[model samples]
Target: MSRLTLAGMALLLPGLTLGGEWSGYVEGQIRAFTQEPQFDEQGDSTFSLAFEPEYYQSWDRNQQSLTFTPFLRLDSQDEARTHFDIRELLWIYAGDRWELHAGVGKVFWGVTEALHLVDIINQTDLVENPDGEKKLGQPMLKLSFEQDWGTLDLFALPGFRQRTFPGEDGRLRSQPWVDTDLTTYESDREEQHLDFAVRWSHSLGDWDIGLAHFRGTSRDPSFNPVVNRDGDLVLAPHYEIIQQTSLDLQATKGDWLWKLEAIHRGGLDDPFNAATGGFEYTFVGVAETDIDIGMLSEYIYDDRGDDAPVPFENDLFIGLRFTANDVQSSELLTGLIKDLDSDALMFNLETNRRIGSSWKGALQARFWIDVPREDPMHAFSSDDYIEISLARYF
Candidate 1:
């Protein structure tokens, strides 16, 4: 087929098209701190440049296709934050009732807005953001079957990826930095450890449900204190072998949406159960204006309570979302998470709007309030900062 003809078909058929395209975005960001750094090596401000480019093509009557996407970032202050990664490099084959996906890709699982407790397929790319919204591409071979009963997906992952951490000169870092070189894994194969997962999903009327299980090297690691060459204490990550079962569900009813995510894990000292549930109620065209408002609330619980290694053992999350419904798609989201046991509070604000046809701008701010000395977040009591970014798409 001619290139012009294939392009025309691609526009009409989308996923089942027979053409190639390239697109990406370049962004520049600056973060300004509201207070002095707690550590001497830390700085008051930082700047970064990031780029992500994607290429996609499909052929063979749309039964086969491939996508390649790569990401790169350069940070002015933290060397550990400057990195490169292949976000996706996937080859897929689609059949009448089944599909196969191969290569590196990203997958997400969970329903609650406060926390994605069951998302375990890919490792967290912590350097990108502390929110855990970004993930590193996972190398896997996934086979999915679609049936009347439900959809089933099987995953065979070949390698493990250790979670990333900020360096000594980075902000929002632990008191003692992490020494990744000394990282250890419970699996004999270390990074080469193989993992497996399966998920069954179904939709019934206004409800969607998913049940999944994973067995392999755990993505969440514990820190082991070690003394470095300078006799300074540094934490080394230790990966544990673990098994987890999770269930996620969501229901839609008019302007109200409900979500829940729960998980049972066995790996460390003893088994533990955790859950996060939330609801969002949206008001459309509020007061006869072209604006919408959404109210959200969630509860986070861990059976281990305060003894849990990570935070969010007993917490409550409340937030509000606003949409201007303008031509440029302006939006704002603000949330507050409070430890149920004490007066500790964490607040986050995010807003974004399009500048023009090809340009966009965003702002984010984070603050810690009345954090107790023993809380894990106490280390960042003075790390309040505001971040701004501008991006151009092509």
Candidate 2:
């Protein structure tokens, strides 16, 4: 058993009280997808299942309180392949004005509606490898401050698992595994980093506004560029710094709600070329008509220059989000299509219901189709896929 699982069993061992609070949640999901099933220009289709369980323990009885977070996930498919992943395992410390937290956990960064511009916080958004193994986010160490108006955080880059993704030629790109791979210059390597951030929130009557910023260096080792677009040899560069900022505002007028957020990026030493990082923005508006039905719209824009570190270009998007109860029961059972974008159109249907007091279940299905664009050589431009998933949580 993993260390986190052992800790969780310790909590329920009949007569045990460590003066701490313990909680846990379990989630299992199955997904079926078809990528370019007909056209064949985008990718391939797939069907898979996922199971994840998370546990936490927070101890605050004495002057020193610590928290523990741990999780595990397993994935399987009909292709006779199975994958296992350990998501997060970490310890934390807390204080009054100054709190110290160090652990191996996922972070969520970004604040937008349609897409993530600068939300570099931390969260694993379902990463799947070529072999279909679900890869979780890296672990990290963090320190934060709590004030009357807001909070500030300073964190250390994670030193955990490494991942490989598909390259331009459909080949796997290898990255360094900090713990397993040690070379001749191992002693000279820097294993830690500094991640700085600040977040503030305030409310005026029925309006709320939030602001946050995060800046840090890359933790994972850079991979060597072996092949260029034309099959030529190239070299990959090192990272300097990554800085991002987010501003958000939300106001509720009667039953209507409006939200806006913008993100700005800076301090990049350019990976592909040598230009600085650019910026992205997003906004959302929604109205709740009933308990189960609501209306929503979102927009996103990217303004990063062509020569910047990452080659994401300026694109526009607008989409809607609807629940099953928004339409008739027949339509709800058949699912509803709720998205239209510059490069793609999406059809999605989802349902959620509670089980016992500690359990809940959800089902989701989504289909994406790429709308024809002017250019086919662009890296970020592309196409069609279908994803269906069922999840149970507690």
Candidate 3:
């Protein structure tokens, strides 16, 4: 279709459509961030430009309905890296409330506050592409249902000769544990493994709840040299498993809103087998005394596992937020926080500003005191850092 036709469809169909609809958004941002490696560790910095532009068109000419969504992303400065790239292409066919989607894309399985138990259905945020962005996009086929009572999603990743089913010894293994360096395994062309996931969401009066499950092979093992300890070419097979469950509740009364989220992550492949798995729960309560001003507090609890790469095996934080206008068009947030296990304190600040019709800007900073002296798996965390970004929508 012509650009004008698509633009017209995007603008008019949301209100006029009867059967099929065409809609989507384009967003881009530029950001700068810095990190100070703790314990005399090597420090790194980054500046980035990112984009997420999508276009989706759906049509139901008769009993058959079709949906086509194409997405593109480009980011410079992912974590400690300098550049990143990925693509998303999905097509769905539907009849009534049931539909099927195929190809590569992104999926948010459930609502978990800690982001630890929340599984990003593609690549588990454990690693990133050369450009620094998490490889959260993957190839798969999905089935979904959206009804008045609830929503359900079931998907499977097939075709790839990947492996993530607990290995023969039942010990979760990764490339770093098997080999000293991971060079070839980090590329997209070499990825091999089948992944699957399912998610469900329902609503009860003032509360909404969701359940999610994911099973996939490990990305860290895909690039193993397939050699033996004696330097012989031994084809030893390895696999990993990640099982998760979560519960979330939210209610609004008068000027107060309360939210609670709990998650349990375990299975054969979690970082630590010393324990069944680990859990991180979060609680958030907020009250609005005026249209432009509000007060809020958050609590977080973390449990460490043997294989887990994080420090102290646990952490916590509490804070407050303020807005300058009734519309919340602009806002600022700050708080004094303590690290539950380490007994460290920090000052954190974050702000957001909206622009005319199509753009927004954000700034985030954290000041750490008595920072730790260790580096965790994947990338290193910072003792102090500032992140600023501006996003525009087309």
Off by over 4 Å in 3: 1-45, 61-84, 112-116, 124-135, 147-149, 158-190, 218-239, 252-256, 269-296, 305-307, 311-313, 324-328, 333-337, 345-348, 374-383
Q: Which runs of model 1 end up more than 4 angstroms from their true locations?
A: 1-19
lDDT of 1 by residue, 105-191 (tens): 788888888788999999998878877788988888899999999999999988787787888888878778887778999989998
Q: Give the C-alpha miss distance for residue 176 in model 3, angstroms.
A: 11
lDDT of 2 by residue, 97-142 (tens): 7765554556554333444444454532223432122345455557
Model 2, residue 207: distance off in Å is 4.4
Candidate 2 global lDDT: 0.43
Quantify all predictions' global Cα lDDT against the true fold: 0.88, 0.43, 0.48
- Indicate the residue-level lDDT of 236 in model 2: 44
- Give the poorly placed runs of model 2, Cα more than 4 Å off: 1-29, 35-49, 62-69, 77-86, 107-111, 123-138, 158-193, 200-207, 218-240, 269-292, 305-350, 355-361, 371-394
Clashes of each: 0, 10, 9
Which ten residues in a row are the worst by lDDT in model 1?
Answer: 1-10
Ranking by TM-score: 1, 3, 2
For candidate 3, give the lDDT. Answer: 0.48
Model 1 earns a TM-score of: 0.94
Which of the numbered candidates is closest to the native, going by highest TM-score? Answer: 1
